[model samples]
Target: MNILVLKMGGSILAKLPTSFYQTIVALKQQKICEPIIVHGGGPEINETLKELHVESKFVDGLRVTTNEVLDVAEMVMSGSINKKIVANIQKQGGTAIGMSGVDGKTLQAIPIDNASTLGYVGQVKKVNVSWIEQIMEHGAIPVISPIGIDGSGERLNINGDMAAAAVAKALKAKLALISDIPGVMENVSGKEFVHEQLTKEEIEEKIASGVIYGGMIPKVRSALNGLSGGIKESVILNGLAPEDIKDYIQGKQAGTKVVMKKEEKQHV
Candidate 1:
């Protein structure tokens, strides 16, 4: 069974073209691959929180999730955003089930740090792969929200990238981080070129030299984490491109492929 985990970033969700949904449909209906969608809802959560007069703040990109904040996060992530993705896929003739990591303990996590400043943010410690596999076996794509449950059964906000990485590792599936950017690009001969393939050391060197900065840092780090966690391959690709997913499924050079080592290019 070929499984491809797609992490759809919140920033690009709204702007994604209809063709993106069509590609997802093709994946399932055409038997291209079993698609698992892990999505983020940061902007929606912030908007909802602002409407409810809840103070919203983030420390190092992780939202500070108090009880009130967690409530709104659940509503926005699981209720609104998750269904929106499902509806979009269904509209394109694909079967999709929207769910949260809290449902059936799909994602179990522990506090990222004991520091109270970051509040209820959690890092994934376990993923209920059986449940996800069941959904896929039923011919439905699981559109997962990143809310997690803790040891005491408290709901925790899991970073979408981290959540996706954990899911990929647990499923032993390929990971594709959907981003607005095409891929990791650098200036060469005064022109920007996306590195079609990258290894851990090369990614680290570029980061150290400030080539891969800002939001791309955590994304690359998350991809690296997936590779280290037994995922065969990971990539950062443009979600807007119609052929990107198809190309990735065909093992073609469509985006930046993340690898464990430079010589481990057999898969790419």
Candidate 2:
């Protein structure tokens, strides 16, 4: 089966229409592609932390995850947001199972900085592909939360994008990054237009020329990192326009496809 790993950010989850979930169910029912969802809960986590009087800190965009912060993150991501997504999919008449990386040791990880600087922040070192495949074969969508397990049996906070990329690489699946915007946009002359596809070279040029700046730079860099990490394909799709999901699956023009090299564009 062609597996499509859909990575949805917390900010866009509530804004996505019910049709989005419906489309996913339709795709699965039709056997178009097995849709595995990996989601983030940054906004919800922050809110919960504030409510619990926990101070949040960040170092270079990664949350400084003390044991207290890890508790809140896992509670929000694995407990709240994870089930919410499962319920939404079930509401759309689909069977969904929600789990965190710690479940079945799905995402085996190592701390990014030996748990010294970034606290419990870690990157995925390995993935349990068979576990996810078993879930998929059972005809259920697996909704994953980005909380990984370390070698010492401790749960570690993972970056959502990194977790999605690791799963995609392991499953040999296409990674679809669902965003609020259409895709990566570039300004030409004066007007701006979305690039239907971007290569590493082009992305670098855009970044250096200030075309891709601020928040987009990190997002594009993440896509590039995934490519380098063995993810076969990656695309940034607009979650707001859920119809694009089908369009993309049908090989129609949809979001911006990111590739490692220019020659790789033709095959996509």
lDDT of 2 by residue, 1-268 (tens): 7889999888889899898999999999999999999999999999999999999998877789999999999999999999999999999999999999999999999988656988989899999888899999999999999999988999999989889999999988889998878889877899988889899999999899898998788778878877886886789988889988888988898989999865433562
In the range 60-111, model 1's lDDT, one tens digit per residue, is 7567789899999999889988999999999998899999999999999998
- Clashing pairs for model 1 are none
Best by lDDT: 2
Q: Runs in model 1 with CA error above 4 Å?
A: 228-230, 265-268
Number of backbone collisions per candidate, in order?
0, 0
Worst 10 residues of 1 by lDDT: 259-268
Top candidate (TM-score): 2
